[model samples]
Target: MATMNRQHHLRGVLLASVACILWGISGVAASSLFMLNPHITALWLTQVRMISAGMILLVFGQFAGVKPFAIWRQRATALRVVSYGLLGLVPVQLCYFEAVKFGNAPIATIIQYLGPFIISIYFLLFKHVTPTRPEALGMIMAFFGTLLIVTHGHLNSLAISPVVLFWGGLSAIGVATNTLLPRPLLPKFGAVSVTGWGLLVAGICLNVFGPVWQDHVTLTGAELALILVIIILGTVIPFLMFAHALGYILPTTASLLDAFEPLAATVFSVAFLNVQLTNYDLFGGMLIILAVMALSLNGRKMINFLRSFRTE
Candidate 1:
């Protein structure tokens, strides 16, 4: 029993780590696509990615007996699913891709880390929940990290363009919506079902705006191969692997392992893309990642502290 448990634990860790690493590498891959081909717009890439991954997930869900389309049987659930796709999935991918296009993968991914702090703010404002000291401190750290990333300690000069900053901020909001908007539906519909539908719906909406077939960019064989990498290795595979790993490990453990994502992006950006990072970028990235780790590892303690604050 003990050996089996240990094996499961190890498997979970490996799966989570690999998934996150692949996700991080995918960001760099997207960056590469942009650098190699200026004609390839983020809008076009996002549409292709969402449609391709969305279709695959739905098909896989069918084979796995998930009854993927059953969520559409009810009008309310269907509406909610559509909302998730439009407001959650679409913006998250679109804004993040834009951020990566304007900025490097490392900065984009690190900035998206602000999503959790945004979630905390949502809870505080809407649910009237008070944050623990650690949670509050994490938010503060995230703020300074973002400040450094954009301003580099000097507010007068912008280290990155305003476009990147805008997209990064939107990406964080998208992340918050992506995380929170699907919660009520997940219990009844399952993550795969909700996400699959959400992606498909978002894909369709994006296509309506700019159809993938109409994308005028000509692609080389290598560029096409990288596109496949983004669709398969970066998006679908990691998503599935992370979901599966949850069966064997705690969610908190998986969340902590998510730290590898930004790390991988930073390494790959520097190594392959020849992107240079300043001290501000490095320090800001560290603080953001540390804030995520602190929040995840000390979630229960943070909750306890919140309760104590309420009592006081």
Candidate 2:
């Protein structure tokens, strides 16, 4: 039993790592689309990604003899799907695009990763559960680490717009909400089905809001190819992998592993974009990695200890 559990945990970690790696590649992929207008690029990429990913998952679900829409008739299930699709998936992507437009990609990535610590706050306020000491310490370290990366190790250099920050924060909240909202429905409908539906709904919403019928739209061969690759490898595959992993791991544990996205992005940028890596970047990256490790390993124990001490 012990060996089985350990194997499961290792598999979950590997799947989560793959998801982060794909997500990291997205940054480098997206940078290539910058020759076109960012808004158009973002809108087109969003549509292609969600639509393609959703369709592929739906097909895969069918092949696996799984009914992806088994719970669509249930009112609660419908509500959960819409809520997750709109408030979680749609807003996170839109807000992230906006953040990248107003700020740097590295900065936006770092800010979005603040989702996990923000989730700890959400549980504390709503669930009336506080984090363990180690978890809290991890969160503190991550917060500073994020700040270090975003400010480029110069706190005085901070000049982000309030609107950008607000949207970025909203994106972070969307991530937290997504992390928590799928638990009950995931078991009933299956993670792949749920994620597929969410992506489909979110894609429709994005189209409704930013209708692609505008005359200014133009797609070059290179852009179209990039968009296709983004849809397949970046969005579809990673999301499926994430859903599969989520089935085997706790939500908080999954979220902690997502902290690797920024680290992966940093590495991707350094390699593909030929971005210079400094000592500060290395230090901040190490802090973020350690913080995630600490949180994943000792979060629950630390929380219990804190609760017991408080009660005593």
Candidate 1 vs. truth: CA RMSD?
3.6
TM-score of model 1 relative to the true fold? 0.94
lDDT of each: 0.87, 0.71
Q: For model 2, what is the error of residue 255's alpha carbon versus the real structure, in angstroms, after optimal superposition?
A: 4.7
lDDT of 1 at 255: 79
The C-alpha stretches of model 2 lying farther than 4 A from their native spots are 1-12, 36-39, 150-164, 246-259, 276-282, 299-312
Work out the TM-score per prediction. 0.94, 0.83
How well is each residue in 100-166 modelled by candidate 1, as lDDT tens digits? 9998899999988788788788878977778788888888888898899999999999999999989
Candidate 2 residues 1-312, lDDT tens each? 999988888888889878978876675566556544454556656766777788888889988978987868889889988888887787667677566555545556666766766767876886677688888898889877766655666777754566667767777787777766665676568877888888888887787767655526567897777677667777778887777787678655776787677777777767766656556656666776777777767666434543453343
State how far residue 267 of model 2 sits from its true place (Å): 1.6
